[model samples]
Target: MNIKLSVVDQSPVHGSHAKIEAPRLTVELAQLCDSLGYHRFWVAEHHDSVHFANPCPEIMVASIASVTERIRVGSGGVMLSHYSPLKVAECFKMMATLHPDRIDLGVGRAPGGTGLTSHALAFPHEPHHGDLYAHQAQMLEGFVNGTLPADSPYSTIKVLPDSSPKPQLWMLGSSGGSAGLAGHLGYNLALARFIDPDNCNPAIFDSYAEAWKKAGHTGEPNRMLAIACICAETEEEAKLRAGTAVYRKLAAQMGQREDFLTPEQVQDRYKAMSTSEQAFYDHILKGYTVGTPDQCWQEIESLAYQFYCDEVSTVTVTHSHHDRMDSYRLLAKHL
Candidate 1:
């Protein structure tokens, strides 16, 4: 299929590890992936969440890029609704100044937190009255490229460290809602298939391609899909490790905040679940690619082909750090 593999780490607080160790693990993973030849290593942003430790992906991106030489580092993404687009552009620009072409500025419209936390993030400023995500995105690109309309109030303000290459801009969305906007504005589209597997299909890429063509873009659309995946030497081992992911999804659905459970702990919890709850867990598992290395690669390749995209970014979580690390190592052997 001639596809590239990437990573989107959520800095999960797993098993007995302290919350602080998650970010360190992200760096460790990035280093390993860099050496193993992963294309991009992106961190995630989450606020007020027990499962994920990274609230600010920009800082993590800089840290990861400093240690890794080749892989692209970026947010999976920055929630643009919470901050000014100019500030976001400046943050990425500063990183690009340090890391050059190795940086990516992937932005999303989601709040990245609970409603109360989302509200607090916008404190001191009046709640925005409308859907300004598109506007923010446009302004962000304008600021990044020094291309804001001449009449705009901020047109005269130039982003500093401007001589350095700019970070690649990406619109991150689970559904196809932002595909046209991303294409029309010349940003790459990274569909979070792991977040919304049901709606994630070739049509999203088609939408982006159509919009790109309509906007007079001259070449093929630049896009990728991210999937939740787990790998092990055997099917049983992979499914066992995936229990942690299934339990994490259950906990999130129930509004619970707990460290990621070990596979053993998840097994116990699964036995205790009612039949319906068990069904829910099984349903979540269906969204993930979990199996042996060959099994995972086959599905990932098929998905990339189906989506007409050349890159597939993986999001993997396991309670045992060794198992998690080994999963990527095994997957890399296929490459």
Candidate 2:
């Protein structure tokens, strides 16, 4: 089937050396994906999280964009709730000015961290009182596109280095809650299926398209689906590599934060989990698209068709950097 393949890297902390290795590995993977003909390479933002390393995706986008020649580089999502919309617009606009047509500003509503980190981010300023995410998103879009209403408070202030080919704006969501809002704002939607695999709803895409048309958008409303995928030449090897991610996800669900373990170590820990924990682990395991190349492709194809999306972005994490790279390489080769 015809589809555009992309990548969303969380720069997952895999082994003991992740503190120094993970971020660098992201650039390396971007180079690989670019050469492999992947469409875009997006980095994620996190805060005070042991599982992910990079907290500032804007910087990573700059770094990745400088090194890769072809692949689009962007923030898989910036946690918009933590910063001023104007600041975000400035950062991404600067990146776009440097690398026109190659940067994407995908923003999400989540805090990207714990309650404590959220407080840290909002320190000195009282936490926002209401549902201001949508409002912030609107302001962000306005600032980037230079289209804020004339009556708006910030309309007189211009985003400097104004230039053509602004970074593509996207609303990243794990659920359908923001689909319509994204469309109404004329922004693309990127559904993060990896975050909540079982919650897939076709109505989300329908609502987005319907809203886009209602909003008088001229072209097709662009959308993408991001999936947690791990592919290998053999299914057994793929499942073995996925063991670490399964254990880590379940551990986080249970409120425990720890570094990734080996597949063998993960198996030992799995054997000790209680019945409920094991069931939860099983559910987590099922959420991932794990198998040989053809098997992974089949599931991805079906999911894209179901969601009415033509672009598929994969997020792969494994204990070994080579394994992680191989997973993406194999999937790209399959296509």
Candidate 3:
């Protein structure tokens, strides 16, 4: 197993930290990840959430790429439905131009939000036409390969000043549909184990690999899994910290403002949960690797070996930025 590691700085804006400071922290973390031999650093896109500050992934990737030397930088996903395929290709191509070999384009099928927020970000035209993701993916491939039609209006136009050496494309998914699609298309797959906890069985990865073979793709498909990771010096300390982080995530999932509570507050909240609620919390947290350094390494190794994942992306969400940074440090050392 290669045991490559990546970071998805989701830009979770804590209640205490100034919203403006989130980007800086993210950049700093990216640089640190690069220096520590991380394979990639991805930023996620979100809007209308006090918890997350990143609304534009391309700009953020560019900024982080400018400061890092070796690490690949890209979006955890571009949330494809929100923009034109051509525009998405152009933006990432521009990023590839600047960073050259250090750029990736991970696309997601979902709109990434719901209700008025989704409406606010909706594309001008029907975003999801028949097989929209597949069509867009094909179009994007054409743009990257410079093989689109030459004379016809839409097909003929090419992304200008394209500096990309053909950006690596990956499909981001929380379910099997994305896995099958990515495999069929011969693109990389980024599985979010932390998102769809109920559906995160190792069999999903087996299905992906089998589908890749069935798709007749000559090369092995690149498979990645993102997991919540919290590592500390002691098992108790790690679990405590991870529990606190999980509490914050649950609060956010329940549409509450995240990061407003202190560690003590998190503990109190966790204590107030009923048995079923605690079971749910424990299940979600099970998707995470949290313990002492040895235990964390064991769990991560088990996950990678079992899933046959090419890389593991760790999203460290601790109350303290220092603790988050420390967790990454420990992970890098072990990974």
Worst 10 residues of 2 by lDDT: 122-131
Task: List the candidates ranked by lDDT, beginning with the highest.
Answer: 1, 2, 3
lDDT of 2: 0.89
Q: Give candidate 1's TM-score.
A: 0.96
Name the 10 consecutive residues with the lowest summed lDDT in model 3: 122-131
* Model 2 deviation from native, Cα RMSD in Å: 1.4
TM-score of each: 0.96, 0.97, 0.91
Each model's lDDT comes to 0.89, 0.89, 0.78
For model 1, name the residue pairs that clash.
none
Structure candidate 2, residue pairs in collision: none
Q: What is the lDDT of residue 205 in candidate 2?
A: 89
Pick by TM-score: 1 or 3, better one: 1
lDDT of each residue in 1-335, candidate 3, tens digit only: 76888887787665456768887888988989999999999988887766567889999998999999999999898887677778888888887876788888998876666555666666444435225777777677677667666663676675875433667888888867777777776778898877775687778777778778998979777788888888898888888778766886677677676454666776788789999878877877887889888898788888888887768888887666677788888877765
Which of candidates 2 and 3 is the stronger one according to lDDT? 2
Question: Tens-digit lDDT track for model 1 on 113-218?
Answer: 8877777888977545227999999999999988899999999997894545799999998989999999999899999988978788889888888898899978
lDDT of 2 at 235: 96
RMSD (Å) per prediction: 1.4, 1.4, 2.4
